[model samples]
Target: MSGDIQPDSHANGHLNGSSERPAPLTVAGVAQRLGVAASTLRTWDRRYGLGPSAHVAGSHRKYSPDDVARLERMRELTLQGVAPADAARAAVAFDPAHPEASPAPSQLVRERAPVERLLVDPLSLAAAAVEPDPRRVKRMVEQEVEDRGVVRAWTGVAGPALEMLAQREKTDLPGVEPESVLRAAFLTAVRDAAVRDDAAHRRADLVLLCADESQRLQAHVVGGGLAEVGVQARVLRAEVVQDPSQVLDVVDRRRAGVLAVFGAVPGAEDLVTAASERGDVAIFLVGDAAPSLWLPHVHRVRTLSAAVEEMAAAISTHV
Candidate 1:
């Protein structure tokens, strides 16, 4: 093999910004570097005998940097449909995963699920509900309802988890996004709960302001549910201006006393803080913006139904 050096190159590196090659890596370090659970590496060893090595002195099980490099090469071949055993042999025989050394995506995947695996854990039945098809997601939600009680289905299975998955579904992770459909499903669960006469009968004049069209769309699905609960809303899509004068202006001009959807702009807290100055209006937020981030000022709601519930709570005195 031509002696070349680069970081994470299964082969000698000429591409990565390195001059001299570094020494081989250890098994534990490889597992960390590859971002996988160590158990997976142990399994790969038993199944494929990959990166086999003995102890340095105490006969401790270990893998060398070169072994990690070889395994990485094998991962690439396997990704391209080659058998893992064949790939392992090819890598050791000077066929590596990279032309110049760099941490390959395949190596990362081989070690563990991607960094965003929590969002797509198949066992996380709740996470699977983010599909665009409302019917499919609702069906699952109904199933959850049957399995668990109404409140448990919402707070335990569907609450904070949906909030997190919504963030990741937009990320670059490759997986099925079943959020909207799931949201629809969970909404069905909450709405199915026996509607009690809301103690307070206050009218909620709600206004939704979002940064752009896409954010606006997310807000509407939420806003539509509120309308069902008798909280009338006028949805407005606006560019994320630095000042809240425009937001306040719309709220004032439209005579909307409640602002529940404020997520289009990332700096929603600032807007909520600004709205707080208006004191007469009640502000609520749903999304990554922490409820504790700006308490009392803005009620934090993760899902559409929660937003509606928040709206109901705020005007409880009148409702």
Candidate 2:
């Protein structure tokens, strides 16, 4: 490798096997460094075939700087709605003068006030849960919602980022209970995003107010993903009254296109019953719902990946 360094650059910036101090970047490393879910890398590897031949440690995965750069480029492409496989190919062939490319990361951040303050700043949400860092989480949620919309912020940013914190804290890592703060921040973002100008050509999007305990958090995530693509999502995270008849009023008042509940939560039967009464709007009871209680209008998403995929497809189909 060349020992020369560019102006204002360190030789240390070069990523490869040349350094003895720093270990080679693994799939997990890149995932963490890039602030994306590990599952996203697996999707790129399996679906787009964007990785090494195999890891030196058999099942382990390693990525060179080129690989990480390609992944970031691919993210820019796919988030713009290009398919993963196509994005992978495009990343390999990106040009400095590429006309189709929108703003660079710097410009995108500078131009969008929200994305700059929340979405781009990596530790904004993480800081919020630490009490000492309340604004961090709130800012992150606000940025994501403002940039991608409420549902998108809820799912893509707040949900996963909170889960990451919970996992970190659960394993006896540093930090306090971030769940409440994160939820509050997400709710704030959702409310603020709801009144934005809607496109005249956009279809009538539904707001799903999740009111079941088990479904509340999952529903919030779903709501966020929905918001990313311009769908409306409201989350009433718990307070689904036992009176199924009265529940109809909440759904109707919100003009909900879909009523979603967390099937894993207790009193899920009541949730299903409430949805059963709503004949017109689609009812989606997420999480593990009993097959016996299944209704035709109800849609169940088993995992985060499944939910993201479903939301993307549904948005494309409808909105």
Candidate 3:
């Protein structure tokens, strides 16, 4: 990593001149280093006053090492269950210039006592969902995704909690609005996992679409799972596409190598028929609601994990 950092000629004076300070990084460079979006960094700056400290005339803003460190701390804290506003405040207050003044990563983990308690057992998460503490539930779900891969995290924690919520809804339980909380948290995790930095994989066209308008969650699961293996997918919600032609347009535009349609919503058969007509792209049918009558050239799978494996295999063979 040290070798990757080269001193800027402008910062370091001429051959005979004394060496100057190291060059700060641009927004893109810092974003790549931190594994976050450049827009996210901009948002932090605008909202939390965490912008670059060093500014050169007639040039773009550049972040010093200290600024990077502070932002890194903020990201770490936010991911570990700290509220963004609170995390930003703490990060801004931290003295990144003084290494000893900053708390260790382990200390940060220890600070999240409430969230830690919720993650102590699977039963605790389910119990928390009964009362529906949205913040706690979101944090637990995020932590699970970080610890386990997307597939395992969804299947083991988020999926079961959601199932419990469905059961509670059937009984008309009070204070249970799990849908909004779960959807937001799950989408956030999916965005975080779906990093498209690899040039080779970026061109590999893989699309995951929901067959039914209400069955959007399964598409997210498949997208997240595909992301774990470094495959980026274009996720199309069911409502976004009106008919088979629209789905075909997306596939053609993306030059999709593999297309996985999830859910058992109405008109799925028509969509499958249209996709099957395209001989080049491998089509897959996934989820419990998948069509009972399997058509030629359509690969069917029951679970998200299986869909992920099938997608990976198709990409490997076809792309």
Candidate 4:
């Protein structure tokens, strides 16, 4: 770990030349050193009042040495299994002069929420979603997809975070802004990735459609992952086609051999039944909220990776 910047003296034995205080670190700089996201720091500051002491009217908040020390202590406590709220309380009460006086009892208790066990730091992406700059959030989503690919990134990070955000929205009454921003950014990123230049040459035999508008994002993510590995999955939103026959018409016209339906749309069973009549089309039920009713040759997949794999295999075989 890097040492915090001090204002006591210069590196040399001589006294410092100026009387001005050392400039406090920005959120990004402090976040980099602390091994956490800048948004996470902002969230801590907003929720726990552990913000920087050096504040300007028009500028970003800056973290002084003491502020950074408190944050470091907060991180340490949280890592030792303390709840964030309790950890923040302990961190705020921490005294720099007395190192041994840190909150050992809270750390020893190892208090954690049930949600934390389900997903590792699910609030990170949620925090990023509420950032002042939507562009930064979008860029972060694109970068995560670029680095981790659509399937893993969505499953491991975006999916869990969005789920947690939804739960928070229901219980905490946090407005829909955070979840909406994150979903839009994620959908935009994945849809951009799904676009292929050689679309005319490659046959898009896999058709993905969600009956519910809420499930469209997952469908797009699955389609995007399939596209990454040479399968150009055709994604259609529920709003575009109200009637099951409309999707069936596209499937029949395009000679699409694989059809994946997502979410609990009203006419999904009817659509699946019609699609099943055409023995050539392989049907797949994708996402958690997909219809439970199953027919012969119908496959069910609850995850993005699973949906992509099944659909890709079906497409490859059909082509």
Candidate 5:
């Protein structure tokens, strides 16, 4: 009976008569198997220490079977709403040889005891700047967005994080390069929140555009925030509309109820003037730019939150 080879009915692959193991998996292979982005795996490795254990000389690091299993547990826990830090701790301690010996997901959840903490507070930015962890910053922003809505997440977390990064950039501190990563994370979170509605339901009630080609990020933030409140807004990136005249065509073609011009770039006054001349669509001017004349159709808002509130009000009136 000991020598007899019984084919495993449950296992995908049969082991040889001898107790041999498969080769270590590459990062790509592990990412594919776990259904996570390769970059995500690297981030977990770099930030959480959930990386490959086997490293050969002059060759890429390879993930052992146990390493992959631990990461898989981490991914599972995170998807189940576990905090990244707690999940990473659990994963690192998990024994792959005896999975049953590891703490159950529910036990892990109970042990961690979920607390509804405001991950991003205005005052917290100061501490975040003092001890910056880019991974933690990205995760907190994303988690806040999921827990709170896009507006709260932006105002409370992402916006402050970006402002801090910008401030740091202005200083003479070297090796502080968090702008690109933080921006990418914030954009991805906002965009994902924006596109949750069905395509047919995304009809344009308001068209959000940058004043010129330089305020695209502001345009997107406004658009995403508007989208969160069920206000369908067509966001025109700066690259798409080079001239103010091009905006007229978009407003005409879309029959947009409102036109929101963000920031005061070059030719913003002309754009506002042209839109006002139409006298058909309500125009919202955002930022510090003062209107040349107080036109009945044009309204100026000081902040993105105010812009969203104005757009929502406009939509309610039209509906």
Candidate 6:
């Protein structure tokens, strides 16, 4: 709104020789414009000084056209495999008068080397998840599954990316939105990859449950992987059931031969004990912090394939 530094109106939609100044954009608006998460914009602003120049003291920051252009340049550079810090420097030095004068080819190559690993790597998946770009994340995740199968895709792509997000949550922002977005995309992809056994006489042989909602993806991936090998695994959510004992009831009703639990569920020993007592059932404790339960037929597994293979073997033996 200041007379000394009005951004180009054309950049913000004013055109056809119009002289009107464009409306200022809030952080959310700019985030929407750039197809990135609001958290990402805040991170850039805090670390790279790419915040709105129109920001006034004691007022909510709003991006001017020039600010948006700089961010656009920053995004472009980063997407081209340029490191964020390097891209920020280039973005800050962007000359609005010559917007086409982007970072030189030589500069791009020099800056891109360090970040090239992001292209089709777990780093890229994590970055996409942080950005919370559902469509892109969904495609990339499913592609990993299609190319590497459920087990590899979960271990090499989705799992690592999710773990990265979880770690970042502890060190960075205190919100679950980014993780939730990635999980949604991951579950969609894994669920779609499932090769369900639809035969009327084919009953589910295994019942899968996560320790909590956070481990839902692991359970789903295991279920999907089991389905691929012609094993029927029923995925049950402990959170969805009113009581933990109800999970056991479902298992009994389904006549599930294998009970595989992912992650460390608090006070799950009772359920594990009950399941273990079912002489006909095989119990599996999965993940790094698998519960140390004093029960029989308890198989501890740490990897997706191990869990699937063990459950499949149990089912085959039971049959």
Predicted candidate 6 versus true structure: per-residue lDDT over 131-230, tens digit per residue: 6577778778777765566777888877788778777744434564767777888777766655322231144455555456556678888887776555
**TM-scores vs. true structure, each candidate:** 0.35, 0.47, 0.59, 0.56, 0.55, 0.56
Per-residue CA lDDT of candidate 1, range 1-319, in tens? Answer: 3576435434333245554544455556777876665545643553345644534543234565456666666666777986455565566553344445544334533443432212222236544554344554566556655444344455556555566666673743355556655666665554443222111112434445353444454455444444433344556656533456777787777666667654456456677777887677777766664334564556666765566667645543321
- Cα lDDT listed for each candidate: 0.53, 0.55, 0.68, 0.70, 0.68, 0.70
lDDT of 5 by residue, 1-319 (tens): 8888875432212354646655778778888988987657755764467888876654445888678878978988899998787798889888876666887655554354665554467446434544556566666666776655566677777677667656653553477556655666677877776776313235445555555544556667777767655567777756544577887888778778888776655666777788888788788887776345467689988887888878767765552
Question: Which 10-residue span in candidate 3 carries the lowest summed lDDT?
Answer: 8-17
How many residue pairs of model 4 clash at the backbone? 0
Candidate 6: regions farther than 4 A off: 1-119, 167-176, 195-204, 240-244
lDDT per residue as tens, model 4, 90-181: 88887655656766645644455553122224466777765534666676677677656787778888888888777764443355477778
Name the best candidate (by TM-score).
3
Worst 10 residues of 5 by lDDT: 7-16
Candidate 3, residues 50-131, lDDT tens digits: the string is: 7677777645457876788788878888899877767887777677545457554444433444445344245656666555
Q: For model 4, what is the error of residue 44's alpha carbon versus the real structure, in angstroms, after optimal superposition? A: 38
Report how far off residue 163 is in candidate 2 (Å): 3.3
| lDDT of model number 3 | 0.68
Cα lDDT over the full model 4: 0.70
| Number of clashes found in candidate 2 | 9
Model 6 C-alpha RMSD vs. true structure (Å) is: 20.0
| Model 2: per-residue Cα lDDT over 156-274, one tens digit each | 66666666676664542355466677777777665443333223113345655454565566666565545433466666645454555556677777556666555554555766666
